[model samples]
Target: MMRVLVTGAGGFVGKHLVSELKNRNYEVIAAASSSREDAAAGKLHGLDITDLAAVKAFIGRTRPDTIFHLAAQSNVMKAWHHPSAAVTVNTVGSLHLLQAIQEVCPGSRMINVGSGDEYGLAGKQGMPLSEETACQPQNPYAVSKFAAGQLVLQMAKKNNLQAIHVRAFNHFGPGQEEGFAVSDFSSQIASIEKGLLSPVIRVGDLSAQRDFTYISDIIAAYVALVETDVPNGVYNVCSSIPRMISTVLEHLVQMSDVDIRIETDVAKLRPSEVPIFVGASGLLEQVTGWKPKTVFLDGLERTLDWWRSRVGL
Candidate 1:
């Protein structure tokens, strides 16, 4: 079995990725950013990704054949408010991981997880965003991811490490952080169902469009990429289909049996937010013969059901 180390294993995507990895018979070494109890049972390593010494130590100790660098401060709004911390954790932390891989597991394949936000407003004209698209990151988080992605490519080319960068679009499902739009909407709806909150669902920028993929589909893509003999390059992991937030909200509202009022929250709106973000997974499909299978409406219903079950509805 192949041995893999997944950073940020406690995170939403990380946890799901680790689970998928283990299910595929890969020995997983899960590394979390904090000392919290791991969500999945594995060789857990609690070490901050931003710490260079700690990262190097873990890589040396684990000696994984593959490193999935998924740990980072990914919230755009949070990165906007705390740019320095975002840079430190996302960019600098990624550099530390690369350095560790170079020093310890010199021949390891590294999958540097990146974001679709790295495209910024370039894909707003309804064209499918591709790996060839030039990165014009607007937010601090996007900037950080772009920088780390660039660094990964540059270092991989220079040092001969099997490093590939993956730019994943908006993915949502259970265990997602509450700060994201999907989770927030689901949580609010769950609260309404539980009588913990009013029937009002506070939202922002419902007109914006996103290429949302279910977490399981996203995890399957990750697993496929790992299994495939994909060359060291950048590829997008996303649903080619993009839908407006209004459409998603409409479906969610329809799925809910209760009357829910929609109210716009001024605080939720961000200046210079990308109105539409979409990506094409053509390269991934060509290489791995995988495409996202979950429909947007179906995924939304599943998410709603998850929140409902969690809130005891």
Candidate 2:
């Protein structure tokens, strides 16, 4: 069995990836920055990726052949509110991990998870974003991710580390936190279903369009990338088709049994939010022969159902 270490193993994506890896008979070791309780049953280790000495020590001890770097401060609005903290976690923490890997597991392979936010305003170009697009990060989150991605590539080239980068777009499903749009919408619906709140669904800017993929598809992309013999570089993990936020909200409303009215609250809107972010993931498809298989409506239904179950609906 291949020894695989997953950082941020307690997170939504990380949990799903770990499950898939375990099913495939991989010797999975999950590392959580906080507590390893979630992965404790699965024999996880607690090690903060930001802690350089701890990271080095852990890598030295376990010596995984493949490391999935997923730990990061991923709140966009929070990043705007706390730029320095975001930089420290997203960039500096990644540097710590890279250095540790170099010292203890020099021959190991790595996958650095980045965000579509790195493209920032470049998504406004109105074309399906390709890997060749020049990044123009508008916010602290994007800037930090872009810088970290650059560092990954630089380290791979300069130090001969087997590293690959993946820029994943908006993904949602079960286990997603409430701050995300899909989870927020589902939670509101769950509440409305249970008579906990009014029929009005509060939301941010509904005009913005996004490429939303199911969490399973995102995990499948990662699995394919790791399993394939593709060369080392960046590839997008996203659905090429983009849908308007208004359309998505309408669909969610249609799925519900209760009557709901769309209400916009300025407080919910993101500052400097990109209007549209559609990515062309041809590079990933070409390399791994993998494409998003989940339909948007089906994915949304599953997400709403998961929230409904969680809320006892």
Candidate 3:
């Protein structure tokens, strides 16, 4: 069996990825920032990527055949407030992992997960951003991720490391935290349906459009990339279809039992916002024959159901 080490294995996408890999009969090392004894227990291994010595020791010890570096400080707004922390965790932490891999597991194939926010403010160029498009990061999170991505690419070329950088767009599904827009909307809708809160959903910047991919699709893309013999470079994982936030909220309301009213909350709005953001996955498709299988409505329904179950509605 192939040995795989997945950082951030406790995260929303990381948990799903670990499950999928296990189902595929791969030996997966579920590494997380912290391990919960009740839920993760024996399966989860504690790993703080921010610590270079710790990262080096873990990689040297396991020497996994494949390393999926999904660990990062992923919140955009939070990054804005704590730029230094974001850079340390996202950029410096990535550097630590790469250096450890170079020293201990140079032959291991690695995938660094970057964000579509790396192409910030460039959505004005046109629809469907391609891999060749130059990244123009707008926020601290994007800047840090972009810096880490560039390091991955540079190390791949200079050190001849077998690594690939993935520029994943907006993705959401069941178990996602309320920090994201879709999850926030779904959670609010669930609370309203369960009579835990008022029948009003507070939202921010409903006019902004983003390319949303189901979490399952994103995991599939990662699996496909790891299994393939594709060249080392950056690839965009996205659905290429932009949906307005308002439309997504409408879908969630329709899926819920209670009638919900949308109310704009200035507190929820980002200081810097991109009007529209979408990505083209032509490169990923051509290389791996991977395309999103889940339709938008189906994903929305599943997310709503998950939230409803959590709220016992």
Task: List the global CA lDDT of all models.
Answer: 0.86, 0.86, 0.89
Candidate 2 segments whose C-alpha is farther than 4 A from its true place? 39-41, 265-273
Model 3 worst lDDT run, 10 consecutive residues:
35-44
Which runs in model 1 stand beyond 4 Å of their true positions? 41-43, 263-273
Candidate with best lDDT: 3
Count of residue pairs whose backbone atoms collide, per candidate = 0, 0, 0
**Candidate 2 global TM-score:** 0.95
Answer with 2 or 3, whichever has the higher lDDT.
3
lDDT tens readout by residue for model 1, 17-122: 9988888889998888666666464556788878789989988888998888899998788999999999999888888888999998898889999999899878
Which residue pairs overlap in candidate 2's backbone? none
Evaluated at residue 145, the lDDT of candidate 1 is: 95
Pairwise lDDT winner, candidates 1 and 2? 2
Q: Model 3, range 208-271, lDDT digits (tens) per residue? A: 8889999999999999987899899999999999898889889888887777888889997763
* C-alpha positional error of residue 254 in candidate 2 after TM-score superposition, expressed in Å: 0.9
